[model samples]
Target: MTWPVVHISRSLDHDVAAVSSVAGNPANLPAWAAGLSSGIRQEDGRWITDSPMGVVEVAFTGPVELGILDHDVTVPDGSVVRNSFRVVANDQGTEAIFTLFRRDGMSEADFQSDADAVRSDLDRLAVLLDKCLLRTR
Candidate 1:
């Protein structure tokens, strides 16, 4: 199944090309995406992240997998969560739609928390792009 996602961000620099460049590049995800540990793999049209939340695998235009590990204190084992991101140009900035698909038995509260994390990431992205452009000039 698929889930509806929506997010909007505006950049002060107004450099559409630069904004687009950063958004499309999966390698740049860790630079701006909050709670992301590292960008591990970038091959065969996929980007992998060693995320604190889980092992996140993101396709260039497919889907993202967020593994929910089994720890005694929290979530149980054998649970896998999937997500996706759709980026589009909006005025001078960009709008990112994050789609979330989860396994059965998961709670809506978890999904809502995930949405909040995306909001934090978007804020980071704006600062990242601004820093990037400043360094180039």
Candidate 2:
């Protein structure tokens, strides 16, 4: 079965390198990816987080310095969800894009809700990165 894919993106004021560095780090998810987890930690070399559904493991699939933020999330049921996220140059700043998939068995309403969550997370990432840039200046 083919899953519907939606690309949710947010334009950030910081440079592409800066956005990728922060967004690609699993340790920083709690601050921006509110919809994904409340907190995250490394357990036995795996990034773990507690979600509304249950405990999940997150792993970055690519290097951050290259603007690739793709990751795989292992849910409580042992299913691994691949998430595509990338940061690209936009003028003097960056555009962070998250590719969300409408998974099997997910209703239309649930899919829309998930898309909204991704939008919110990207917005939060922009805010967080802006704060970091401000502090460095």
Candidate 3:
């Protein structure tokens, strides 16, 4: 069965490169990604963190210069989730879009909750970038 994909986005008052520089870095995940804010550490070339569900391993694959922030999360049960995120230049500022694929067996309510979480995380990211931009100016 094919899962449905949901696109969530947020506009940030910064350039694409600046947004990508922070979002694309695994080390910065805890700073903006609420779900992973507890903490993350690298072990054996994999990023590991403890989620509410359990321990998860994350693998990121994308080009920072191109603003591609795709990553895969391996749950403790061995299931893998793919997250597609990107930073694009908009007329007024930069837009960060995240594509979330609903996992198999996920209920409608669960999917909605997941989307909300992603939105919140993006909001946090925008705030972080805004603060950084202010500091440089």
Candidate 4:
């Protein structure tokens, strides 16, 4: 499977305590994530949202439980593309990687567009972190 990745990282001027607090809070998903309006409650403890692209749901499955947000988009010819948003924290800071993929043949133009969209979304994340996650203290 071919998956294109777009990654972004920034170090907040605050300590890990503040950064971790925001990273660990699932309720703040929509605050930063583009296309995501609100996170709905589900039975399995995953946050759900009706994103700009489609209906997306995120779950924490790993030790850090980096929330996974995914939704599928359909092309006119009945092909499907999967879009995913992943958020994780490291010594540097919180990192977000968005990927786009297709099961069948997909054009390079489509892939580039998809990657650009993800990059724009991450751009919003940078603003969100500055405003909501990291505050002057």
Candidate 5:
């Protein structure tokens, strides 16, 4: 069965390429993605991190481009979550969009909380990008 999807977006005052460069790299996840801020390490070609739930693995399977940042995250329970992230050009800056899918058996409250976390992460990303822009100027 197809699950529900929640989309959260934030506009960053930075170039699309710049945003994509940082967001597309899994190494930068700890800096922007609060959910994975505990830490991320690589083992046997897989990215691993510790979450409140437990140890999880993340794999970024998207092409490196200006607007694509897809990845699969394996939770501690062994459930895989697919995230479709994008960084698109907008006016003089860029807009980052993150797609979250409601997994099976997830309650409405849980889904809402997950969406809020995504929004917070996107906001943090914008702040990081803004700092990068300032440093380059």
Candidate 6:
């Protein structure tokens, strides 16, 4: 069965290249993506972070230069959660989009909370990019 999906997005006053450069980098997760992680470190070519659940690995895939920020999160049990993320050009700026899938057995309330958190993370990312606008663009 297909899971319910929601696309969370935020528009930034920066180019797609700029957005991709910062957002696609896992090292910058603590700076903006608080919902996903507080801090991330590279170990053996893998992005490792401690989540509320436990230690997890974030492996970003696809061409980041093309604004494709797709990634997979490996949990403690070794199961992987695939995330569809991207940044697209919007006028002179860019719009970052994160696709969240409602997992099996997930509650409606919990799913909504996840969506809310994603929105907040995107907003934080936009604010961060705004601060570094001159350097990025």
Estimate the TM-score for candidate 6: 0.94
* TM-score versus the correct structure, for each prediction: 0.60, 0.94, 0.91, 0.54, 0.89, 0.94
lDDT of 4: 0.53
lDDT of 2 by residue, 67-134 (tens): 99999989999999899999989999888889989988999999999899899888888888878778
* Best of the two (1, 4) by lDDT: 1
| Native-referenced Cα lDDT, model 5 | 0.85
| lDDT at 86, model 4 | 55
**Model 6, global lDDT:** 0.88
- Listed per candidate, the RMSD to the true structure in angstroms reads 7.8, 1.2, 1.5, 5.4, 1.6, 1.3
Q: What overall lDDT, based on C-alpha atoms, would model 2 receive against the true structure? A: 0.87
Better of 2 and 6 by lDDT: 6
Quote the lDDT for 40 in model 5. Answer: 92
Steric collisions counted per model: 0, 0, 0, 0, 0, 0
Please give me the total number of clashing residue pairs in predicted model 6. 0
Error of 4 at 51 (Å): 4.4
Candidates' lDDT values, in order?
A: 0.54, 0.87, 0.88, 0.53, 0.85, 0.88
Worst-scoring 10-residue span by lDDT in model 1: 66-75
Model 3 TM-score is 0.91
- Comparing 4 and 5 by lDDT, which wins? 5
